[model samples]
Target: MAMNRVQFQSGLSLPAFLARFGTEAQCEDAVARLRWPEGFRCPRCAHDQAMAFRRAGTPYWQCKACSHQASLRAGTLMEQSKLPLRTWLLAMYLLGQSKTNVSALELMRHLGVSYPAAWRLKHKLMQAMLQDELPRMLKQVVQLDDAYLGGERNGGKAGRGSENKRPFVVAVQTDEQGRPLYAAMDTVPGFTRKALAQWLAQRVRPEADVYSDGLGAFRAAEVAHAHTVVEGEGRSRCEAPSLRWVNVVLSNLKRSLDGAYHAFGFFKYAERYLAETAWRFNRRFHLEYLVPSLLRATVHCKPWSEATLRGVPTFRTEASC
Candidate 1:
């Protein structure tokens, strides 16, 4: 739709957003239009010209031939969710529009839900957004580095013996005009050649030029691509104009964790936050397009189970709750 920044910012207002997509019916109609841009076809029986009927106040489509029924929320992030469609859309807008970040507490106040419910909703939507905007493997010149997070108990020590405090995150990505692209972060026991190689192998595209500091762990990266080490004082080789950008990314991440979550236990969920930041950074110029594109993309991806969504082991007692 070629949504510019002005349009994106203005469109997010409750009144304006509701004006276009106010009611659940209107939102469902938009979803149906987006999902079946061509026409309605029975998902189960492949029947065309399905008749839609409201069952118990909810709209349902039934195939005339096979009588297969499908609800508007079927196969979507909204599927099985208790929250209203307008609320979900508003949350998406807040996530997209905010410059710093919106906290679960703030969202709770905004959506008028309980803290736990709001937390779960935010996490789930963040996961969906993460899945929606899976970054393409970075090409051309790529920058690599590692950052330590959550290690205050050991007097800010980053490596060994700080396991309980915070784990290290190995990051690799490119910077295009101050925006990070294709960034990937992995929790590691410590930053090492093996860990760096593993992260690179999984997230980086082979044959792309790689740049990094003069770290021996990054030496093996040359096997896959042209590697250059930017040495000398004050020379930040990575995407940022200086090493400051990485610090900024880290500070923002820490602030988000501190203000919203208030602990390091949610590190698993923190990855989704990083993914969200990466999505925002990559699509900063076209946020409106990005948001809707993500909403649309979530439809095609496989639905995440509650167990995975909660980040609990299937065999664990926590999952029983």
Candidate 2:
């Protein structure tokens, strides 16, 4: 049997990760480089020159042009955080390297922080995961499927109507040889035609064709250039060749979510959780670059306060692309 290159590749080992980001100074240098590849620019005045210095032992950059002082963490997701840069970099490493994802409890143990602090840290990083612009629309033959997260509580409804279930769409674009290229997954209001149309508008390019099982609402995928209906349901639908990659991605998603978290507020925080999985998947082929890529995204993400993180629940708006 041939080895799967993506699964078998030599990823960044723990020793290498430690050597690169082991100390506060190393982590700071990495963050600075990722945040400003050319060099430091003033966030306020767009000046390219700046003076680096420490105030009360905290690093800050003063723009040579406007004299505005910006802390090392200012304007980024790490703003207002009191945790050491090493700790933040470690969290990114653990998340980017983990196959099944990390839970707050596990992160709390790893970081030696309280559970609440760990929870905040995890969600903030997940928000950073979503800061990347949405991947360009799938442009090849694509497989689509509907999936759900969460299950009924004891004595609650047991089917799709269950209050616990959150509906999401899964899509995988494949090459001419049927190899998967990219995947997109996100929550929807429901599996209605209007809802699917809104999602397809944002994700499916007009030049692509979408394949799906016999769910009538999937007809909304006609908003693309083409749509093919494969009639099946239940186990048969899951095994159907037309939807193979979508089902495979769905199965992996279920396994990862189940293994990483015993429970979470899936109804409210589904977007960030799903985005975290998709972000990792889209970057799976480049494991060595995972932490640095995540760091780059983190340094670009606008700050999100705990109150804002707790307040906003992302959903697909009705507006079409």
Candidate 3:
């Protein structure tokens, strides 16, 4: 019999993680390396003359240009967070190592933090992921489908009309061999032409071919490239063999959400979660660099407060992509 190798293997073991990031100093060093790999420069005045030291037990680089100080956690997602850098690094480690999902409850237990802090850290990393840029766009042949999370109502409509379900779009790009390469998922009001346009503009190329079921909203694909419509009623593309990898991706996403979260927080935060799911999916083949990549992204992204994530931002969720 042929052997089946596990796709998701551990890149950084627990022992390795503990050795490198067991202390605040180590975690701060990692962040400093990522944040200012070239050298410390005054973020405000573009001056490189700086002094490195610590205050309140946190490392700070004081710029001589204006005597302004910057910390590793400053101006990043870790800003304003009371949790130690070690805690933040460990949280990110657990999130990257898991192939299925990691609940905030589990994160709190493992990281030894309170539920509120764990929840905030989890969401903050997810938010940072939304700001991270994928290395490539979805191109070549792509499969498109409308998907939803949340359970059906006890006495309401079924399937797509079911109450409490958060509606979203799933698109998977495949290589010439019909294997999945990358994916993009985002929440939408409904599968409208405008929604598709907004999603494709950011994630896909104008020369790509898009395949979807018989939905009018998918007509938007024709605006730039080839669009193929498959009219298969009463069947889900998630299990259909034709789309193949797209089905596998959709199935795994729903399973991960079900396995990890209670209700995926609120529907308002669905886009953030969905974007995060897509990020993990696209990086599935590279399990090793996941944590470092995510941590780097957190450095690149601007700070997001609990207030910013509470309801909605001025940019709007649909356009946030």
Q: Which candidate number has the best TM-score?
A: 2
Count of backbone clashes, every candidate in sequence: 0, 0, 0
Q: In terms of lDDT, which candidate is strongest?
A: 2
Cα lDDT of model 1 by residue, 1-321, tens digit: 776554355424556666767788877777788778888878887778788888777778889999889887787766767777777777777777676567788899998988877777776676766665444466655666666555446454445455443344434354556444445444544456776676567566886777667768778787787887766544344334534455455556667656655553433554566666666665666654654665675555455656667673121111111
Model 2, residue 59: displacement in angstroms?
A: 0.9
Candidate 2 Cα lDDT to native: 0.85
**How many pairs of residues in model 2 come into backbone collision?**
0
- Model 3 C-alpha RMSD vs. true structure (Å) is 2.6
TM-scores, all models, native as reference = 0.79, 0.94, 0.90
Query: Which 10 residues in a row give candidate 2 its minimum summed lDDT?
Result: 312-321
TM-score of 1: 0.79
Q: Candidate 3 versus the native: TM-score?
A: 0.90
Q: How are the candidates ranked when ordered by lDDT, highest leading?
A: 2, 3, 1
Candidate 1 residue 27 C-alpha distance from true site, Å: 1.0
Residue pairs with clashing backbones, model 1: none
lDDT for each candidate structure: 0.63, 0.85, 0.78
lDDT of 3 by residue, 156-248 (tens): 788777756777878889888887888887777777899778667767798898888877998988898788886666546445554767777
For candidate 2, the TM-score is 0.94
